[model samples]
Target chain A: MLGLSKKDTTFLLVVIFLTLATPILLQPFPESSALAQFNAGYPDLMQRFAIFGIFAIGFNILFGLTGYLSFGHAAFLGVGSYSVVWMYKLLNYNVVPGLVLAIIMSGLFALFIGYISLRRSGIYFSILTLAFAQMSFNLAYSVLTPLTNGETGLQVYNNDPQVLMSEGSPTSPHFFGIVMNEATKVDVGGWQFTFSNGYYFCAIIAIIVFYLSLRIFRSPFGIMLRAIKTNQTRMNYTGLNPRPYTLAAFVISGMYAGLAGGLLAAMDPLAGAERMQWTASGEVVLMTILGGAGTLMGPVLGAGFIKYFENIFSKINDNILHSWFSALPDGLEDFVVFVFHPFIGKGWNLTLGLLFMLVVIFLPGGLIEGGTRIWNAITGKNRKKKREDAAHHPKPTSHVN
Target chain B: MGILEVSNVNKRFGGLQALGNVNLDIAKGTVHAIIGPNGAGKSTLLNCLIGKLIPDTGTVMFNGISVLGRKPYEINQLGISRVFQTPEIFGNLTVFENMLIPCFAKRDGSFRMHALESIAAERDIIEKAEHMLAEVNMSDKRHMTASSLSRGDKRRLEMAMCLVQEPKLLLLDEPTAGMARADTNNTIDLLNQIHDSREITMVIIEHDMHVVFSLAKRITVLAQGTPLVEDTPDNIKGHPKVKEAYLGEAAA
Candidate 1:
């Protein structure tokens, strides 16, 4: 189905089902329960999950497949957001034109940046990309203030000339006449689920890009990228140029970042220089690595994992911690909160850092490898099978004199 | 007329003349061997022909196209493939995938953005890869990782990768540099089969006398970056200049 192998098709179907049903899946805790704070069914956080998921998926194409670590991918994401917002100021609140322009503009940016950055590979290449991204961030923050609105960020204003806006059209970001922020709440007993127009829109785009990434992963171009990563010497002798292949991958991944950035603005209708920061670039790298760099579903899983921690874990303040441990003795409760304080709320980075370290050390292949290990353990499939299989298919022995 | 023509090729490296005043004409459809001792500049001359290094003053032409300053891939596109001393197969990919890359290169030129199409859908390329694997006696190991293959198998796979392109001239750089007696003979037999079956020209640079005499139709004795003599294998075996090249002053 869809020109994919049976295994890939099944994997893709599973991803689609999970993405479409994320609203209910994320709201496992009841509203009245103390654990309700953990529920991520709200439209704002859900939109981030889809948006960042797309961002990491695109980043994986360049970093994972080609083994070219791009440290400035967030530059493309920022460019994507600015394109969409500029479209909103010049065109209308409708997001289609903004999204279209976001993709095209970011592609051009990626082409220029990729052409230059790809000249040097390894750590030097990474530093070059980092430099370019930082340059872009500075430009957006100060020099390009007229376009980016300086520190205030770019937003749709009543005074701006929205050339395509009609009298009765929705004011906020919307597709046609449907407002993006509009949501329908479904309550089952104490549990609440929000199905938002914005989340679903981002979810649909995420699914499409995920499918495209999957196709690229299985395509000949994907194999060529892997070949470049493995051995450039062999590739050249085989009559394949690594430059064009790597550049194409870089542009494609940049476009993915752009699409994701555009989706972020579609949900919020704002563009800021902070989106292009080095930290933002590092976040996608963390997402790809934490999920499993080379695996298809790994990046999305990593994005969700990090976003969940950022939203849910960071909300665990001192009062919340105290409330949870209130049943214990006063002295013990104080000690418990003190121990947990450094890893939650404003210190959530501390927690994320610890987890990232653990994952890197114990699960070097990322969360996907951990999952595979668990699955293999459950199925009783051990490493011994490799030896047995090799034994069974012995290589044809060399002919003797 | 020879298919590969090298004339007045001189390469120097800071007080060292690696290949000085080298010249040769390799005929089409013949297994020609260039035999020399260590530091005789055999590999340097091979590198010059393949565009890995440019000679100070010379023209290295393949079928009349000068390959002096062309990129390695560009030279490869002009129908010249090189197999390294150590097998240079893609270690991370499976053996079958390794075969498919060269086939794709042969059909698609240097670049093609066939990103949306599935690799399995390329039926013709798959067939060609399978046929080539079978020819190399590696059909059973097609699914195995290229790196996991035995040393002999890696060499065979590398040779198969080059042959899949069906290049006009095949350059083998020490095809049996370090091998057991049995594996070396097996490689010789394999090379003999390939030479007998295909209309392909081959140039072999070798340190092994056995490998040199067993397969070469015509032989060039290179001594100190210059061709001392070019003769048939039978004539080369007893040539006084060839003796002096291999044995130094003792043979003279």
Candidate 2:
């Protein structure tokens, strides 16, 4: 309906609905239930879901569409965060300027990095990006201490002049008068739902960027990107230069990462050097691959899945484990808890690693492929039945002929 | 005067002289064939024409402009399209997508940012791509992945991809290298039909004499990095230099 085909329109609508209704959907368990710990309706975690979704969606444009595995997206993310915090320090706590500057700064950084990194393809390209990201990380931590504030991170202080701030303005990060931390909590019997302003703000931006990515996926530019991924030799002979196209994609994805970083600081007025670490860069890669690299919904799904597990699964401490298995026989309960100990709580990485391995081995196309397979299996039988029925009762046109 | 002019082209690879002082002129709107036994520098000469190789000392010109040292895309932007020995279509994309890329390249030079516009909105490009696919008889397989197609179908799709751009000059490197007899005949017929239908110039490199005799208007026989003779296909059949190039000196 929005210049998209009927199928793509429907997919986009579904994504929008899911993003908007995440708070209610995530809080499926009631407060009194034993599984209450699994509920992710809280503001902080939900903000992360939307923020990382933007990051992964952008990363997918490069890594997914062009097959350019960038190990340095986290640097853009950090740049975005620092830009927002700098805006807060110089101007007011309003996120708009910071977010705009974040996109511009990250895009500039991406243009510089992408111009050089895109000269080589495949492993060399990946290593070059990795090197650039690490350099940014080290600079932020040590060399750029004057700007980054070194290990202490960049946060607003009382003495710093917020020139835009007035007597009536909100003290913390906000979109104009609307405070990001403000939430309305509702209680219905044992169930509670918290609708946070920050989550919705991130959700709206996430939806917009997601739609943009979807358009890119179906555009002629997207086709060129895929052609680059498949065969550059043919692309050159077809009169298409792969270099400029790849550079554009790199910059675009970098802008996306920067926007995501801006959103991170908007929710909490803090910019940490740790955000640009290699591990942070690696996380986005995992999210894209785990969910589905090229599919429209895969990166978002992957981002949500990893964030949910990271938050809920890591909170499963020994006490919770003991309480869940307390009803069992004493000896058997201890043994069960012991067996599951390494896979939960502090050992969540082990579980994540094992899941990543399984996804790679059995479902190389990622979670989206698995979903498509299951969907096909359900509808395939009905299609076969319909075909048999049609065979049994041939059309009257055949008899007339 | 001809559309393509190659003069005094010399190429050396370390101790080996791949191409040695070669020269040729290819007329417009004609099917010219370059034929030789293995290692006779047929491929090397074709590479020089398409900017894949830079000859040590030579001038390769298309229409009045020199083509030496230009990038492959730049060479193509000057209205020259190349079909590789093995069909070099984007194997990961659909046959229809394969056609759209060349059409986009033709319409929008080398690079463009049409990221926001939907593919369906490009009505003229779509219509042209569809028309080309229909002309190649690959409309039914348009949605099929390019890699899944049979070898003959893949070759046809690759040709369609090139033809959709409507290049003034078309270069084919071994158009039928390892095809079955039936598929080879089909490809020959397709090439003949394409040549008859368009004002395009074609330069084909072939080891198969049957294909050369059927399609080529003029034939150039190369033996050991130099052209032995350039004549009509009928004259080339009786040329003893051509016989020696293919069957060796003992047979001649």
Query: Candidate 1: what lDDT?
Result: 0.92
Instruction: List where candidate 2 sits over 4 angstroms from the true fold.
Output: A381-401
Error of 1 at A158 (Å): 1.7
Native interface contact recovery, model 1: 0.85
Candidate 1: list runs displaced more than 4 Å: A383-401
- Candidate 2 backbone collisions, by pair: none
How would the docking of model 2 be graded?
Answer: medium
Cα TM-score per model: 0.97, 0.97
Q: What is the TM-score of chain A alone in each candidate?
A: 0.96, 0.95
Give model 2's DockQ, 2 decimals: 0.57
lDDT of 2 by residue, B98-212 (tens): 9999999999999999999899999999999999999989898888778778899999999998888888999999999999999999999999999999968999999999999
Superposed by TM-score, candidate 1 places the C-alpha of residue B133 at a distance from the truth, in angstroms, of 1.0
Candidate 2 per-residue lDDT over residues A112-229, each given as its tens digit = 9999999998889889999999999999999999899989999999998999899999999999889999999999788899999999999999999999999999999999999998
In candidate 2 the C-alpha lDDT for residue B17 amounts to 85
Q: How well is each residue in A1-401 modelled by candidate 1, as lDDT tens digits?
A: 99999999998899899999999999999999999999998999999999999999999999888899999999999999999999889988999998998999999999999999999898999999999999999999999999898789999888999988888888899998889999999989988889999999999999999999999999999999999988999999999999999999999999999999998899888999999999999999999988988889889899999999999999999999999999999999999999999999989888999999888878877899899999988987866785677744434211110
